[model samples]
Target: MSNVTTKKEVNVFIDYLARCEGETALRLNVDADGEVRHYEVKLFEPPRFFEGFLVGRKWYDAYEVCSRICGICSVPHVISGVEATEKAFDIKPGKQTVMLRKLANLSELNMNCIVRIYILGGPDFLGVNSVMDIAANPATLDVVKMALKLKRLGNDLTDFCTGRETHPVGIDVGRMLKLPDKHKIEPLLERLKEAKEDAWKVAEFVASLKVPAYKRRVPLLAIHREDGYALNYGKIKSTSGFEVTPYKHDEYISHKHVKQSNALFYSIGEGQSFMVGPIARVVLSFDQLSPDAQKMARKYWGGPEWFHENMPFSVYAAHAVEYMHTTDEMISILEKLKAGMDESEIMKEKAIPQKGQGFICTEAPRGLLYYTFKFDENGDVQFADIVTPTAHHVHNLEQDLKHLGPSLVGMSEKDATMQVELVARCYDLCCSCSVHCVTIKK
Candidate 1:
């Protein structure tokens, strides 16, 4: 951290926020009167054009290529794309396929949240530039060690089911090419069951951090499943009390590229922005959390009102709670698999793809990621649209930055800039997954 001299104004341009994924900039300008004169968020990382790349490909190919969009988000991207494609062809996977897919998602969510809450957000709360700054610090190093064990547990779970951690190969349209039998699932279930104690320690460690607080009240949106806390399946629900099916996202949601920027933002109406991810999940579905997670959340925060849109720091707490939820739920899912409670869907032959459109929303580690596809008669993709969680969040993040300006403007350039950067970290922005090529610049 640098010290502020006599400068009344300072510009902060982070080439890619340290610790977060991808390369992008969060630039802010502050004036002498404790006011933010200029606030701009430009996601200029060169684009991959995944949607365009998928067009003219087969439905299965869409899932394959889309999974390459982000390493952290691969599970959700691949799962959502597969489910949407299956829907387009009116194919339904059986009990085993659904359970296996949920396990993969839960594994990804726990690992991804660990990275965000402990690795990226850790330094910010510790008043350091990066985790390396605190690697030798006795107080914080234990959290890092705990995070590593939890992270491996998540990756191994995914690997057992998906064949590899990143860009899993097994999952496909309708069902996976191979299913893990009780023999393979039992050991992993034991590992997950054993990790419960560690999960509690990490949850308590995270809740002890003093996250900076604010009072902005943006709407939080997440998937709402009737069976439980929604993850892979549910209608989308907003904190403002609106619900819509996955297929109707197009009807109720609209997104456009911001002026001079390629990153597309989603909105429900004019001048409206909403949040997603763990914070939204907890706010919108706290009661739905597993009993263990609900118990942990109750230890620190008083009630739902304590989870505010402006308090981006609470996102860390939200992740911790979700980590417990995913861990507990995975143990249960694995037990079900071990008991032969349902028939393995792989026992049936695969279905053929047909002409039609399909849509789906899966709760990724970040938030609800929506995918839509139109297939030709031969099951080749004719059109594709992917609405990433980050796409829906860029604007919401900027809004929080702008609102926090007053509190930071009076500080020296160096101090204020670091604090503002923490504000962005609160969102755990994944620039690599969100940035799209643009004709405009800031």
Candidate 2:
């Protein structure tokens, strides 16, 4: 054998991943000896400019506009945007307001995770092409029904709290424009209580599936709190043993430009990239998970080492655990709301824009969602920046492919391609939110 050089470009189809979130292409270069040399995770979507156009808009318009970033994650974008605005103006929401915001965040996390774990990731575990195919098979039809029912309940909970299901309109900075109806709380809570069994069924279903094994130890970053599982509130903590407030994220996590991607790549200083999302959150905050969720995690995920090891495929398993945890949290919050609604929670105050800067990093269902904003004295937005979770994961996914691609040297192209897709789906990439800016050189 003299020499062999092969190049292949693969476009990830919608059927391979969950609900056609967006498009990403993979380019792999394999050398003559069957060793992989280079890989590029190409993002084709045009630059969205969510951050670019935000300048010159009013401060209050930030969340409403940024919320359009992802239909699946509009709630998280809104919450992050609102929190960033609150920080800029020095507005401190009451405890009830914080609790209700947590409810909103948890509701979306529950909904997004159910979709990813059951409706989306389920087909992969079951070795099927699409969820429709899962429904067509008599053996898995019940699984489909259960997934849909659970998804519906999640949507209802999100809608009840946020106003509309997607791109919700009831929440704003410092106050709730619309509070959840008192009469509806009892019924919603009852439905949530009833869904606990269904939640377990989904988790058990995931636990039964075989997870592809490929391990790597990349820095895992998440928002952490000492008192409880942190979603909206907490300092940024990483598996590397570094803690930084959200304001200093720029000093630690830095963004880079790559010709292969329209989105930017982020690293925690030097050339090392880090992973964020469900896996990071679960690993960093395992101690803070609800007791029931912890029991399920240990039972299904094979104790803590499986997570501590930082296995990429374990992301699916992590999503299942988070689903269980968020359900328990939602029930607890709903019970409190059912007992009585505080007048302060529903009250709204007008925000006076001051010339100041604010920064926030919150957990979206997929992972860390970050936002920073500056306002003029007249309450107009002087500048805005957002770093979505999908953008954060893309580079790490490429790094994972580098580690996994060499293993595919002897396999058939089709089999090798699928293994690649499996890893990508594991990140639950939301491409829509990732492609925010593209570089243009004059």
Candidate 3:
């Protein structure tokens, strides 16, 4: 078969595999000129009907219900959901509450990033079929074991803060059910210290790989923070210097509906594309990284290219650096929480439901996750809006493929196919999060 026809065949195979992840479809047509004739990412996960479903529910109900959006991204959904509700009610959670929330976000990041690197994305980069294949191989078995340990730390952190890791309970508006006990926090911090070392090993392994020398000029976007890395905190920062409060998401950022997909894709008012998630966070929030992580980034990437351009290779390094930073940051946080451990349950507040709107954006494992809610005087949800990182990411990934097409055209079929898959997997694309924005057809 000619190389052009083979590359097109691989694109078809990717679309088939995408169904296993979510109801997503991709169509790429390359013209005789070896340029992209057409490209589209269509997501058709069943309509969730979430916004209409929450219409008459109390604000506190959002944390649990919105969490159902995606099993992997539930923690951020819950945290950002509560933040939006708290903003509408004008309530600020106590110190301990905020600390616990931060810990939960870190845990989610660890779990998701590890699975993507060692399992899903691993095979693509290694030219193997799956993590199972890697695990069964004598040469690579030890690598999989190390990855499991890192993923376990994320689950441990989640379990410590919220009695349940997935679809966590006890995080109502203005309330945190109970902080992890001293007993739990003490042991977890110790294990995390060890996990830090293992993370370094994982980082070294990923850094040793040959990263694709791909670059595209899409605008990068992420939440901005001054105190530290943005997680359930900060204002929106885009590569273009466009900054806006979360409330203005609807005003400054806009979404477009394509008949081919169920998800709503976003842009910065002018219909321009932008990338989000780890690459955006790592580049935009570089200064805020801990000293250790900054040193590591310098060691691996060795220059400022990642911060200035959209190089997919930077995504792996960015994820590795953040993985290390989160381990240390969580250790520090656990020590403090352990010292002040108390047996008290979440305090109840008789907050009167105020009539207003609330908006918030937080860094989730995947990238910039956002939420907005409007409430009636009775505190019932009048309307709700959510934009997951995957939705915002679709355009950047497709654009990248367009730029990457020419180089892929004449390569050996297998090499060409793998390169295309590697590029798609680089975003760590989470179709579940993207197609989750679906609604019932009117």
> What is residue 30's positional error in candidate 2, in angstroms?
1.7
> What's the C-alpha lDDT at position 326 in model 3?
85
lDDT of 3 by residue, 1-442 (tens): 4554444422323454421255555555554457776566655566667777889898778667888888887889999899888899998877778878888888888787787778767676676788888899999899999898888879878887877788887566776876666778777888888887887787787777775777776777888888898886678888788877765667767788755443466778577778888878888888887777787778876744554563676677777888887887888888788678544437656466799888888888778887889999989999998778887877666677677776656566556656666777777666666644443234
Full candidate order by lDDT, most accurate first: 2, 1, 3
- Model 1 TM-score on a 0 to 1 scale: 0.93
The digit string of per-residue lDDT tens for model 1 on 176-200 reads: 7777656778778777777787877
Give the C-alpha lDDT of model 3: 0.75
Clashes of 3: 0
46-132 in candidate 2: lDDT tens per residue? 677878888999988888998888888888899999999999999988777788888888888888777887666767767887889
Candidate 2 total steric clashes: 0
| TM-score to true structure, per model | 0.93, 0.93, 0.91
Evaluated against the true structure, the overall lDDT of model 2 is: 0.79
Candidate 2, 145: how far from true, in Å? 0.8
Query: Which of the two, 1 or 3, has more TM-score?
Result: 1
Output the worst ten-in-a-row residue range by lDDT, candidate 1: 433-442
Model 3: CA > 4 A from native: 1-13, 18-21, 258-263, 307-310, 342-345, 350-352, 412-415, 435-442
